[model samples]
Target: MNFDTNLILSIMPELARAFGVTMLTWVAGVIGAALLGFLVAVARRYGSRWLGYPLRLCVEVIRGTPFLIQLFLLYYGGPFIGLSLEPIPAGLLGLTVYGAAYFSEIFRAGFEAVPPGHVEAAECVGLNRRQIIQRILIPEMTMLVLPASVNMAIILLKETAVLSIITVPELTLVISAIGSQQYAFVESLFLLALFYWGLVELAGRLGRYMEARFSKYRFVTA
Candidate 1:
C-alpha cells in the first residue's frame, strides 16, 4: 500500500489543535507536580516522623498504582462524593498527582545528595536555615536532579496520551479519531509517533541547555 502524504498534510490543522491541548496539559501538570513534589520532598526531609511517615506512604502508594487507574478514580470517583470536575481539569489534576509522586522521589534523592558538610559549612559561616537551603542546598540539588527531571518530563509528555481515554481530545485522541474515520490507521499512528519524537527531542535539548547553564558557575569558579 502507498503512503498518502496529502492525507497527512490535510489533517495537520486538527492535529495542531489537539497538540496544543496536549502541550497545555503537560505544562500545567508538570508545574503543579514539580511544586507539589518539592514540597513533599522538603517535608519528608525536614519534618518529624509524624508528618514524614504519612507523606512517604502517600508517595509510595501513588507510585505503586497504575496512572490510568488513578485518572479514572479521580474523574469517575469524584462525582460519587459530590466533587464534579470538568474533563480538562480532571485530566490535569490526575497527571499532576501522578507525576508528583515520581518527582518527589527524584527531589528527595537530590536533597540527600547534598553533603551534610556543605550545610554545616554554610551554618558555620553564619548562614541562616533559609540562607543555607536557598543559596547552597537548592542550587546544588537542582544541578544533580536536572537529568532525572528531564527524563520524567518526557515520560509525562507521553503519559498525556492516556488522557484521551477519558475523551480529553488530546493528540492521541485526535489521531485515533482520524484513523478510525479515514481508515488510515498506519499513517495516523506514524504521525502520532513523529509528534512525540519531536517533543522528546525538544525536551532533551532544553534539559541539556539547563544543565550547561547551571554548570557554568562551577566551571568558572574551578
Candidate 2:
C-alpha cells in the first residue's frame, strides 16, 4: 500500500482524541500508583509484621506477574467477584496496582538512604516521629527519589498502550482502527511510532527540567 500523507492528515483528529485518552489514563494511573507506592513503602519500613508482611507479599506478586495478565485479570476476572468496572477504570486500576509494586521499591530505597544520624539528630532536638519524617526524611527522600520517579512515570506512560488490548480506545487502538479502515497499515504504524516518540521525548525533557530545578533548590537551601 502506498504511504498516503493525506490519509494521515484525515485521521489526525481521531488520533488526537485517542491520545487524550492515553494521557488521561497515564496521569490517573501514575498519580494513584505514586501515592499507593509511597504508602506501601512506608508501611514496609515502619508498620508491624501483620501489615508489613502482607504488603511485602503483595508487592512481590505484582512485580512478578506480567502487566498484560494483570490488566486482563482486572478487566475480565473482576466480574466473577462482583466487582464491575468500565474499561478505562479497569485499565487505570491495573496500571496503578502494577506500577505501585515497582514504585514501592524505588521509594523504599529512598527511605533507607536517609542518614541515620539525621534521624538521631531530629530525635535529640525534641522532634517527634511525625515531625522528623515530614521535615527531614521526606525532603531528603524527594531529592534522592525524583529521578527514579520520573523514570517510573515514563514506564507507566508506555504501559498505557497495552490498554488497547482491553478496548479502552487509547492511541494504539485508534491507530489500529484507522489502519483497518483506511487499509494504510504502514502509514498508520508510522504515525503511531512518531507519536509515541514525541511523547517519550517530551517526558524525558520534562523529567530533566524537574531534576535540574529540584537539584538547584536543594543546593540553594544547603
Candidate 3:
C-alpha cells in the first residue's frame, strides 16, 4: 500500500487537538498519583498494622490486576454502584489509581533505603516527625525515587491510549478512527507510533534533566 503523506497532513489538526487532550489527562493523572502515592507509602511504612495491612493489600491488588480491567470497572461497572463518571474523569481516575500503586512501591523502597540512624539523629536533634519528614526524608527520598517515578510517568502517558477504548478521544483513538474512516491504516498507525515515540523521548530527557539538577541530594559514600 502506498504511504499517503497528504492524508497525514490533512489530519494534523485533529491529531494536534487529540494530543492536547492526552497531555491534559497525563498531567492530571501524574500529579494526582504522585500525591496519593506518597501518602500511601508514608502511611504504610509508619502507620499501625491495621492501617498498613489494608493499604498493603490494596497496593498488591491494584498492581496485580491489569490496568485495562481496572479502567473498565471504573467506567462501566461504576454506574451499577451509583459511581458513574464521564469518560475523561473515569480515565483520569483510573490512571491515577493505577499509577499510584506503582509509585507507592517506588517510594517505599526509597524510604527503606534511608538509614535508620538518620531518623534517630533527627530525633536526637529534637526535630519532630513532621520536621524530619519535610526537611530530610522527603528531600532525600526525592533524589532516590526520581528516576523510577519518571519511568512510571512515561508509562502512564502511554497508557492514555487505552482511554480511547472508553471514548476519551485521546491520540490513539482519534488516529485509529481516522484510519478506519479513510482506509489508511498504515499512515494512521505510523503517525501514532511517531507521536508516542516523540512524547516518550521528551519525557526521558526531562527526567534526565531533573536527575542532574538534584544529583547533589543523592546519597554518596565516602
Residue 43 accuracy (lDDT) in model 1 = 88
TM-scores for all predictions: 0.95, 0.96, 0.97
Q: How would you encode candidate 1's per-residue C-alpha lDDT over 111-193 as one tens digit per residue?
A: 88888888888999999977887998788888888899999998999999999988898999999999999989889999999
Q: 1-222, model 3: which lDDT tens digit per residue?
A: 999999988988999899999999999999999999999999998899999999999999999999999999999999999999999999999999999999999999998887777888899999998999898789888998999999999999999999998999899999999999999999999999999999999999999999999897777533
Model 1: lDDT of residue 141: 87
Per-model C-alpha RMSD: 1.9, 1.8, 1.0
Give a tens-digit lDDT track for model 2, residues 11-74. 8789889999999999999999999999999888988999999999999999998999998888
Q: Which candidate leads the pack in lDDT? A: 3
Clashes of each: 0, 0, 0
Candidate 3 regions exceeding 4 Å error are: none
